[model samples]
Target: MTETAHPAVSAEQAGIEQALTDQVVASFDGTPDPRLRQLMQALTRHLHAFIREVRLTEEEWNTAIEFLTAAGHITDDRRQEFILLSDVLGASMQTIAVNNEAVPGAERAATEATVFGPFFVDDAPEIPIGGDIAGGAHGQPCWVEGTVTDTRGNPIPGARIEVWEADDEGFYDVQYTDGRVAGRAHLYSDEEGRYAFWGLTPTPYPIPHDGPVGKMLAATNRSPVRASHLHFMVTAPGLRTLVTHIFVQGDPQIEIGDSVFGVKDSLIKDFDVQHAGTPTPDGRALGGDWARTRFDIVLAPAGA
Candidate 1:
């Protein structure tokens, strides 16, 4: 028996798809802001290219729309599902890389920036130097000390440093419903540019995995766990704001993979263990084992 011949896709069909993409991109030509017009056109072109490359079906498109809708529905002031989705997709890290490129003519390297995870909040309680930020979060206490300095090695006095992290159980303050503020706070560097705080020892934890983003990760057979880390956002006058994380050295999750792709070799540090009954740096009475780590942060000049 002779097999039936199948016709190839017509050139007219390909032309129609290209014309549609061109029309969508051109629709943004009237945008008043040049940057906005460029962004819109680029986004339209890339998005249309993706759809065409995938040859997406109507069912798949509907599923994607439903997934995004679910993510929006689950988002609130306390939890941002969109950011989580971006993190799992590595979009957040890519944006950070694009915006935080290296500074030219710098004598010393600045601390690398990473994804500003979904848990940051405005107006965190301010604590004095060497104060505790753990509030009431449960975990082994960690003494986080660091000096804020410019690329030239000059101290940056009075820089504002914001710190936030997950507790031993991998839960952030916002994850709880009792209006608790633990494992997070802000502090200013001292006159000598030294800042220290008490926070939980970084521990590997899964990203909030009960939402649409989590579902996607699960469906794709990917783990949602992030490497053990402590978040920092440091700002000073006339310096580029720095947002990054100091990951625990030797965390297995780092080798496995950080779901958000936020790890950098330069950002990893050793968390030294202090056995019980050891004297604390500030002579605070801690009756149990604790950890300590120092992170010296160098900031780039504002326009650098």
Candidate 2:
């Protein structure tokens, strides 16, 4: 049997496509900011290349526009669908990696950084050292203790530490409608660079899946479940701000894969189980068992 011959693309058609990409890229030449010009031109080139490489159909383009529109429509102060989209796409983690590359041969290695998920709030309630960040969120109580130090081992007293996590039900307080602020707080380190708090033990939870990003994940056969972990953002004067998470050691999802690609082996820590009737660190009475984990954070110099 003879194979049927396919029509070849005319030279003019190929030239037209290349010319369009060139024109779009050149349009950014007059941008006032040099960095903006570079970024726009590069973006245009890559975006056009993708469209051409995929031979994208008009219908598919329309569907993409609609998806982005829906994402914007669902976004609000409490819900950041754009960031969610970035996270699921691995762009968030990639950006973090690019910006937080480790310095070679440094005396002390700073803690690694990771994706900052969408649930963080700027005005998290202030908690005293060793205070409760659970804020009525439901979960097994956990004692989280840590120290903040410079890469050289100098303690960074008064470093601001923000902590947040989802409750056992796999939902943040912001996911609720009653204006709750549970499972999140900020506290300052003590003179010894030590900080501690009562928080919910981290548990594996699915990222919110009721929006456009979720639909995209479903269509792509991707899981939206993140590994169990607690978020931390530490900041101090003259030090690089660190945004990272301490994952639960042996979390099955680590091997399975974190949807946001936020897991780092160095950040995983043991969440030790305390049996029922175990003594509480601050002598708080609890009817059942709890957990404890320690994470010592090292920050790099801002100029590093």
Cα RMSD (angstroms) for every candidate in the order listed: 4.6, 4.3
What are the per-residue Cα lDDT tens digits for candidate 2 across 208-256? 8999998998999999999999999999999999999999998899999
lDDT for predicted candidate 2 compared with the true structure: 0.91
Each candidate: what lDDT? 0.91, 0.91
Error of 2 at 15 (Å): 2.0
Best candidate (score: TM-score) = 1
Compute the lDDT for candidate 1.
0.91
lDDT accuracy of residue 148 in candidate 1: 94
121 Cα displacement, candidate 2 (Å): 0.8
Candidate 1, which segments miss by more than 4 Å at Cα? 1-8
